[model samples]
Target: MSRFPILPRHQSGFAYIAAVIFLVVIAGIAVVLLRLTETQQSTVNQALLASRASLAARGGIEWVFNNPVQRCSQAPLSTSNAAPAGAVNHLTDFRAESGFLVSVSCSFRAYNEGEAIDASGNSSPVVKRIYRIDAVACNGTANTCPDTGSVPRADYVERAQVATICLLTDGAPCV
Candidate 1:
């Protein structure tokens, strides 16, 4: 009567209700996208951690090979308390500079096991050894030998590598 026609009460709040519904839908979408992004970031971080652990394991095995003590079978590995000096089998642990722990184990076997006799068919006590080396590294804790592949915690990441190392006393001259 004064300036505009009267509107129904239900139609009065139509625009406000529509705007609220639109905002809720947008918020839901945003939350979903954020969660996806967070999940992706977590995956990437885990991958990077696993890669670091792998590098740490590789470095540990290399360190074992390059170590004169392990190569010459001179002393008990620093990580082992049960292994005797110059023992055939040994275990070692190395902590990397990047805050990771690496564990290495070597299993020794006689390369000439059944046929240790020489060309003259004379048995001689040779100083040759066959070493099978295995290494594992982790950010939190390392897996022991013969593990069942269970995750200890949500944040722990680990990697393992193995190699066949053959050390002969006659090949490399030890000083």
Candidate 2:
């Protein structure tokens, strides 16, 4: 019996299938990597926005400290209407060199002490003024003033709330 010449079975099709599978896996991995990179970039951007907001809030507090008369005046900071208690009032909007925006608000409350005997048996009633200031900074836009029931944000926007009580001791300390 004559044996047929040895012939190799066709295996070229298997190579193509293996290559396709490998390429699919590589594409999946690439997508995952791209998503991770995007998330990291977003987080960094938010952090930067927060930092700018905080700086703006601090600037508002300092402005109040510098202008004692304006802080105690009945005239509101940014409006002609009288400032009401438990209300937020706008103060200023400043632009930083880096293009960040800062906004400020101030609220004032007056407290009066009952007449009492002093160290020398003198009776007097002391009146004190307390100023609650709120400042906010935003990276790309301005935010509304914070209210009593509002929650504050940081970074893209930052809020700073401060309550300072100044005794109206003949207006010496306040001035």
Which residue pairs clash in candidate 2? 49-155, 50-155, 50-156
**Per-model TM against the reference:** 0.65, 0.65
lDDT of 1 by residue, 7-102 (tens): 775638888999999999999999999999999999998899888888888886787688534553554433222322332222334443666667
TM-score of 2: 0.65
Mark the regions of model 2 whose C-alpha exceeds 4 Å error after superposition: 1-10, 72-93, 114-122, 140-162, 171-175
Stretches of model 1 off by over 4 angstroms after superposition = 1-10, 68-72, 75-96, 113-128, 141-152, 172-175
In order, what lDDT does every prediction score? 0.62, 0.59
Candidate 2's displacement at residue 118, Å, is: 8.1
Cα error of candidate 2 at position 25, Å: 1.0
